[model samples]
Target: MSDPIYEQVRGNPKFAQLVKRRGRLALLLSAIVLVSYYAFMMVVAFAPQILAVPLTEGGSLTVGAPIGAAIIIISWLLTGVYSHFANGPFEQLNNGIVRETLK
Candidate 1:
């Protein structure tokens, strides 16, 4: 037999809201990452010279290096944002839903 608690949680409006919000956030972040990565790849394909340029006059470093680094840093920051929301608001809402459903 299915647990009633699970059924209650499934029926809760807060649970639905949590799922929607969490999913939207995930999708939005994923889209941001995908677009950034793809755009970088497109540039690499069509405009390699731009990325190949030296960061400074006669410098050894290329423009692409810093751009690639920025992409990595942005991804990490996005992950942290998701973690913060998931741990804070999402967890709180989830706990509230469980508590309300149990009572």
Candidate 2:
């Protein structure tokens, strides 16, 4: 594409909004995952015994098992959150921009 056409798309208000929204969403989700994973790692590093504690009086399940599972679940949920935005408003804005730019 020519510089002018690219510049034209960049100048669109909707394009700017889309960029900001997507950036914010991605940063938010990334921060969540990073904070969670780092917190878990810190717990592992500083309190290994805490994670070793059994979930029940006689049960074999360790506390770490569920917490680890939750981290994975949270990652999946974050992905879904992004996908939800991408598949809906983001996609609509993106398609509209493409159509407008092409025309």
Candidate 3:
């Protein structure tokens, strides 16, 4: 059986706004991650010597290590950013939609 509450929520303008905002945020974050990763890979492929440079005069660690770590850290931070908005604003909007639909 079709549910009226579901239909109501689906018909709401706020639901559309929520979907659009969430999708845009997700796409923006995904693009950032993809660009960073692909740029890193491109550099690694075309300019290996750049990453091969040592941090110190006689250090074993290469510049790529920190850059790789930063990419990972940035991805994690982006996830946190998405989670923050999803839980904060998105959740609030969702709850409001559900509450209004139920009423």
Candidate 4:
């Protein structure tokens, strides 16, 4: 790879140590996030109205919605969280790893 950051940290003990310490946790969390993502997607796909709803004060919200939208909304919230843990953490870890190895 033509990555400068990686080339910089070609050989370093601390970098390996850091990866050893945090790699497992990062991987585990990332897997969990991915699983949750899949689960939520499945739910949404099988039951979409389970996520799109409107609030009603007097009567039940039966305005053409499945009424389970609330559940779907909460599930959708997990999507961003999953993305953060998976993509965000991975990127940060790569950058940090390169920087630490270099220095």
lDDT of each: 0.96, 0.96, 0.97, 0.59
Q: Which regions of candidate 2 deviate over 4 angstroms?
A: none
**Stretch of 10 with least lDDT, candidate 2:** 1-10
Clashes of 1: 0
Instruction: State, as a TM-score between 0 and 1, how close model 3 is to the true structure.
Output: 0.94
Model 3 worst lDDT window (10 residues):
1-10
lDDT of 4: 0.59
Candidate 1 C-alpha lDDT tens digits along 26-100 = 999999999999999999999999999998999999999999999999999999999999999999999999789
* Residue 81 shift from truth in candidate 4, angstroms: 12
lDDT of candidate 3 over 27-102, digit per residue (tens):
9999999999999999999999999999999999999999999999999999999999999999999999988987
Error of 4 at 53 (Å): 3.4
How well does candidate 4 score on lDDT at residue 66? 43
What ranking of all candidate models by lDDT puts the best one first? 3, 2, 1, 4
Every candidate's CA RMSD: 1.1, 1.5, 1.2, 7.0
TM-score of candidate 1 against the unseen true structure: 0.94
Residues 1-103, candidate 4, lDDT per residue (tens digit)?
5787555655555556556646666576567666756766786789667554444656566533442454455556655665665466656766676666656
> Which residue pairs show backbone clashes in model 2?
none
What shift in Å separates residue 79 of candidate 1 from its native position after superposition?
0.5
Per-residue lDDT tens digits of candidate 2, residues 1-103? 5699889899999999999999999999999999999999999999999999999999999999999999999999999999999999999999999999999
How many pairs in model 2 have backbone atoms within 3 A of each other, for residues 3 or more apart or on separate chains, i.e. clashes?
A: 0
Worst 10 residues of 4 by lDDT: 62-71
